[model samples]
Target: MRPRRFGARTGETQLRSEEYRLLRDLISERLGLFFGPELRSSLERRLRERLGVRGLDSFADYYQLLAYGAAGHEEWDEAAELLTTHETYFFREDYQLRAFQQEILPLLAKKERKRMQIWSAGCSTGEEAYTIAMLILDSGLFEPLADWEIRVHGSDLSKRCIAAARRGIYGGASFRATADVARGRWFVPSLVEEGKSGVSASVRSLCHFAQMNLLDDERTNLVGKCDVIFCRNVVLYFDAAARKRVIDMFYERLVPGGVLLLGHAESLLNVSTAFELLHLKEDLVYRKPLASTAKP
Candidate 1:
């Protein structure tokens, strides 16, 4: 059957009351991304393009495609990429990072473990994970950790972003917040793309990437426990319930005494109370309680 076509003005129709509720609810349930009344037009505009692509004239039809179509799963994935934000760059939040480097790393170093793991949850294009690895290498704390296991894992909901991450190549915009010293030390000229550079083999060696939905319990479990988790700027998109759920998952994924770093705009104030807020010289971070009364 020929796909339905829509006129310029027809596609511009406001998302209907029922359609808005249906689409928003479905997206929230599946992806944990909440779109409220304020975002109604935004959601309508973004999905209208999808409807045009699919040759469906109405938002209702698009909802049917997402909810009951033969390729519903694939459709959801595409919609997710469209709806989610991937605005990130290397060393985007320097203050929190400085705290992680100056204060947190030293504390972890004292543990004297054979393996160390750091997770960049919601890691968009892999910069955060690579940055953590670079900092670890720069700290020179791991020199004494030779023969020890060290891995920085980055996970995101966008498959495309994860693919870009695994390739380990980036261009100028991804380096906007990056320092020249870090750029010089951790990346070399890219062989495949002119004017682009790939993360140095040494940095890439310690990092891994995977496509994962933060709301997926089984897949999230694969992330296991980590010493530090960077989930900055991600929970802002979620509603209260979704935010709480994700926070609970983070708590589960972090080992005792593990650290949780959030964006400057986000905090656990009412979202959660399980974590203790620790103030560092550069930033404030959260941590799980240690088994003992004090640092081991």
Candidate 2:
């Protein structure tokens, strides 16, 4: 492998040949994430900050420090942060939210058991989970079932994102797609002390954010069962086998008749046989059929 060179004018340093290989192997082995040569420059740029923070001059030394050092855990976290992409916004796919509000919520409202539980798996920055809460609040169906539990749990692989979600403070950029009525109903503007605008209190209370890695069985089990699971774009990064494993695990974690919403670009077609395709009039969702209805 040739060491990719970075021109000095770019103000970024390139990883040495050995350094790139070691980082690539570490990423693959630890997170099951892979990056090709095309990603070399981007990876190097992201890792450069970590190098500067740790005062390391070379990637080999940084790798060794990450692999074996007092700050090994911190290095592990930093590596994960660098590798994981957190590109999410409020109500990213409006069609899915509409389907949930118009179709799913009505069905749940009519049910004898009115409690609703939703999991925003791979929920980065708490936007998706909060969006679900807003939809539920807007639907006007929860009043009759005020006693019923309405839990929205948001989990992500990155602790940084989890923390951001927990803080419930988003800049103006996160609200661009949100409607004015929804914003007023769900969020309250706070004083932006540091040259940044803020969100409201209603949005903050709608979600519980926790640090979680989808690949960990123990963590997944702790989330228990939910009525809806939004795994979304998070799974596309994984290979087929990992994706299948994740879908199966989600199947067990959802109640019968619970819905699973995937990213628009994602499907269960070749990944798992555990879920049945559920075509709504407007959008397609997946359902974990009751045991009696599941095909043997």
Candidate 3:
């Protein structure tokens, strides 16, 4: 597809064919964010703001900055913020969470390892990770400090998002689906903002946040193996090849019999077959078998 001939609107940047291909391919390769031709306009619109901030007149300059620029790392961090969707709320898609609480927790509780960890991959602003901690508490399957080790690790690609997640303070739509009782139980009124609420120290204690690009093998390894991984709505943005790579990393990161929970709109079809499909009472999940081996 050719470049987008931007409208006469002020402060717009023309994304040429070569530049579009270079930028999008680099984006996919670096961050796993896809930009098909249908999204060219939207992509251009968003990056246009970035270009303005950089005072660059062409997408090529932006591409060079992202590719090999000295500030490439920091620039890519900013690009991640621009390209990704960070909007999320507590208790979203409660059905999947219900399956985690009733079905998955019991199964995990039976494991030999007393240290249980659930990684919230691509958690935006920490809502999902905090949500997982709440579920774990509700399960009452593991004691907090007596003999059980519980950790809910939240990670995202954007530093800004990680910072927000670390704060554990949220307002507005972040709590829309959250029950008032649950909110009262798990959160305290935040002095940071009149309408905001801080996630309780009990929940925050069980969780931690970090900024990680899933492609970074070093950082990925630092996450350590987990008992459950919630990568909902994150991998869909990646192209097939990138998706495969990320899925394989996840495979390596999960312990035996560990399960993966994805967004309802996502699935493993055509992505990877390493995970076995689990049909739960209220949701479908992927699991690594207790005695699993490589397919080929």
Clash count for each candidate, listed in order shown: 0, 2, 0
Order the candidates by lDDT, highest first.
Answer: 3, 1, 2
Candidate 2 ranges with C-alpha deviation above 4 Å: 1-22, 55-58, 192-203, 292-296
> Model 2 over residues 1-296: C-alpha lDDT tens digits?
01123322265566888899898777655555555677677668777878889999888888888778899877877778877778888888999889999999888887677667799998988888888888887788888445667789999878999988877777777887988777766766556545443545544555788888676798889988888999888777665556777788898899988999988888888877777788997799999887745541
Tell me how far candidate 2 lies from the true structure as C-alpha RMSD in angstroms: 4.2
Candidate 1's error at 238, in angstroms? 0.3
| Each prediction's TM-score versus the true structure | 0.92, 0.84, 0.94
Model 3 scores worst on lDDT over the 10 consecutive residues at 1-10
- Specify the poorest-scoring 10-residue window by lDDT in model 1: 1-10
Model 1, 1-296: lDDT tens digits are 00112233353656899999999888877777888877776787778888878999799999999999998989887887777768788888898889999999988877756678899988988988898998998998777546668889999988999999999999999999987888998999999999999999889889999988888999989988899999988887787887899898888888898999999889987888888888889999999887634321
TM-score of 2: 0.84
- Top candidate on lDDT is 3
Q: What is the lDDT of candidate 2?
A: 0.78
Q: Which whole-number lDDT from 0 to 100 does residue 107 have in model 2?
A: 86
Better candidate number, 1 or 3, judged by lDDT: 3
The better-scoring model by TM-score among 2 and 3 is: 3
